[model samples]
Target: MSEFIDGVITEVPQQYSPAGELDHRVHADDHSNDWWRHAVVYEIYPRSFADSNGDGAGDLRGVRSRLAYLAHLGVDAIWFNPFFTSPLLDGGYDVIDYRDIDPVFGDMAEVEALIADCHSYGLKVIIDVVPNHSSWEHRWFKEALTTEPGSPAWARYHCVLGKGVNHELPPNNWRSVFGGNAWSPVKNADGTDSGYWYLHIFDSSQPDLNWDHPDVHKEFEDTLRFWFDRGVDGFRIDVSHGLVKAAGYPDYPQHADRAKRSAGGEIIDFEPLPHWDQDGVHEIYRAWRRVANEYEPMRAFVGEVWVDTAQRRAKYLQHDELHLAFNFGHVGAKWDALDLRERINEALLHDKAVGAPTTWVLENHDVPRVVTRFAGVELPKSSGDGDENESADDALRRLAVLTPEQRVVGTRRARAANIYMLSLPGSAYLYNGQELGLFEVVDLPPQFRQDPVWFRTEGKVVGRDGCRVPMPWRNEAPAYGFGPDGSTQSWLPQPSAWGALSVQEQQGRADSMLELIRTAVHARKSHEAFGETDFIWRDDIAEAIAPGRSDVLVSEHGGAGNRALVVLVIGTDPVDRPDSELLVASQPLTDAQIPGETCAWFSLS
Candidate 1:
């Protein structure tokens, strides 16, 4: 499988290996050394990003309209959430059709335009691909329901018989990541009980597919070709660890957590289970890799893999498998400096062993915003595990727990943290509203809330709606310019305070969050030390910050031998730093010292 890109023959070497990877004949060097290896990809939740039409929801046309903004922000790539035909359940993860664009969004032609526009700006376009499961409304799922259990349609997904004498119970006791039974009773098209259960790891509307079927492999291979032909630069695979379940669909380990979660459920790390991170999943990637290799600049796959250890996380990025896997260890860490350093060290060591650069993520669409996360009292990992499943209303009824003082601290810390994050080697991802220093909108009206996690738990859990609120593009309008004009109302309500955080407001201010980000990102893209693999720790700074607050940390990049590309973070409190050429600072330096909540890049003398 190969194609020519700019006179260069780009194709995965056809070779054989038992591990489902390219053979020794095909070296990693043979693969397209794509721009993604050094890219700082910006993740856009399409519905919340800039809206072009007055329809109040973002579409491909809106994304195209905003290419100049992303280009100016200096990101090498833009990764969009799924825009495929979907029921909008699970935030569009329940894809109804892989090939068609949703009506709410534009058509395939609009997508082609968006890609062309992005390429014009020298930005690569990567769209979401939800491969682990498809919507119950999907054509295959509908046919699988009525075509009999052993039919071709049924074989495409994990459609199977239920248990008990009358087949009344679910197929197994497996739990859904969204809570309740993982197996949902199948209803015939004629509106009668089918007495069989189908597997859905998340929402019941999203039924898991049977990857063991050869047809499933061929179908996705064709899909890869479909998008590759369409000029899509890459795909962010929804659940890369998922695809092939362990044989027999066994129950989780006896000691696994019963409290269900969408993140691949409770990971029983010590033992392998029915699904999630199975070795067979790699074989699928190898085949997909061949398909991607056939393209011009070589399409990439970024996996949303949620594994426990860094060692296990590294396995997915093997030579022939996925190019990058999100390190959740850093994503879930608290605001404490010690924990962050430890996570960074572990991530670096693990990814380095597998010859992959470690990725850093400060905030994403799924979780609480970094400013909000930092504003609150830094909780231990177990601090707020399950808050008695507080309903959306109940949670909103509570006062704004994040105090004004806390917000100021949180915002500063977030901006400074990002500067430090970008300075690190490897790639980084910036979620939609982080540039505006937008905290989570934790108080959306009950009627406006839509995350499936809320309904799945019977409103007992307020899902990730807060962070997914419509972005504030301009300072004016009740909807904060998320939509086209002042008259259009955004799908999700924009907070009144957003007028202060809007991009329109931040444009001219030198000290605005947007400006800080623009400067840092520019430095990241153009710095010679950046994107280099050289990293060293400077522990001597601990003497200045003192033992009571050993929070200050400095990391030297690029200058491995004589000179150094220095990055010192004075997080806990302000501290004097050695005088040097200050390249960029998240905050104004005081007395030739790195101030608290500031990360400064330096050009060593």
Candidate 2:
């Protein structure tokens, strides 16, 4: 591993031997100061990971119980969705308490224990911080309601007097990401007009915080110190590019607003959006980076900054700002060789210029699962006005729904895609259940859906709840083994067909999705070429579409450019394999050739 004087090189701690856990990764003798540069982090939505007390919700203790499983899976860190105290609106994004864990998830003690357990398993812990907004129930917001307009508590949030007779109209025509108007009128406890409104870019229950307030800045610093002292390895900042809105919160030109913006022909790069990715946001991060650097091991921060272009995304990764900002280009690109190649190259080139590691991600909790997105349908846009104001809705709705045949194709492509993602330079994030080859559950009975987008949009949009379902543990009668032995209640419903996809069903089978992931992570962690932050496009191995050989996607990097090419190939063709030792393959090749729908790593040693 590359070393830097400023970086922390950690020795592998004596590990924990939990029930049914496998210790498979090779422990490195040395590591770089930037351990996160090439790390593979797994995202966990706590409420869906496991339910320890049969409370029908996944809790911190449940995560502790499964720590060994994650460790065995060979991930470097676990990035959890917010488990802070909340009112359950926006699925915990509407955080009421930043200092303590939500009672439903467990308390502060459980969080401390979970972190210790993860470290014991040689895994780091990164928790989510929803800094852009706060639950309306937060003490600050509640007090803001009681105080007069322009009061200190009111100034902490985006609270302002409405415009019109008796102050009835919203401050501006800004739109709510959840749906409808972004401003919600505040009423006094006696149910009378308070002559003011609060800006809630998301659900009305989540009022946006005023980063302009000096107190807000100090408050987050305090929050960061509290958790860092508690030993969290790092934090994944929610809406990292969104804490500061443009001055005045002006209206976005409605005429220019389009329902879908995607990685199609023209990117969503040059639009004059006023609410997100503002310059002031960087100042906040520059200060945050300073706070993160204070501790040993140099605490890390990954941004969920969904800007329109790679260059814009890179701006957040400037040395003193954020360590990593997600590049969504590859994740949102169509499942085409050219589209994928260009996105990856563009991200690598931009990040290289910025002297930052490029982050490659296939899917996350906020968007449609890649399997469904890459089914060659209209790329399902995550609900909101972010990507060109929404997501890509260019494809006809008829093709959006995956048919039985489409699912098979999608699944195979997804398998190959994951290997391709693991092969890329720099860091990567794997959402929970991604290894299980999970797709968005579109057919959830309308009644079972809980995403606020469904209600806020009056069912016009389904939002991302489908991707957040509690994962299947085993093939049991109720909840597919999500809860306790005899329980039927999980926060979300599990599909009956998921029985075959359960961890118990796929555990050790060579062709199983679980095995493919385990082997891929194991191989990725061990390979020298895969760990470095470099990618040299294989100019000779052109991507084609002629049937069998056309499906191949190859990119090689690491070591001398010409001396020994580290080739990563994914396709279905029976061919003369790369002239190298096969380090690992997502699935066994056919007839000694790189098979279709499989990805293989080769070292030309």
Cα TM-score per model: 0.88, 0.87
Model 2, residue 570: displacement in angstroms? 7.5
Among the numbered candidates, top lDDT falls to 2
Deviation from native of the Cα of residue 441 in model 2, angstroms? 0.9
Candidate 1, residues 440-514, lDDT tens digits: the string is 787788898888777777656667888888888787867787777654678888878899998888864778888
In order, what lDDT does every prediction score? 0.75, 0.75
lDDT, candidate 2, residue 602? 67
Q: lDDT score, residue 275, model 2?
A: 81
Question: Candidate 2, which ten residues in sequence have the lowest lDDT sum?
Answer: 1-10
Among all candidates shown, the one with the greatest TM-score? 1
Task: Flag clash pairs in model 1.
Answer: 246-274
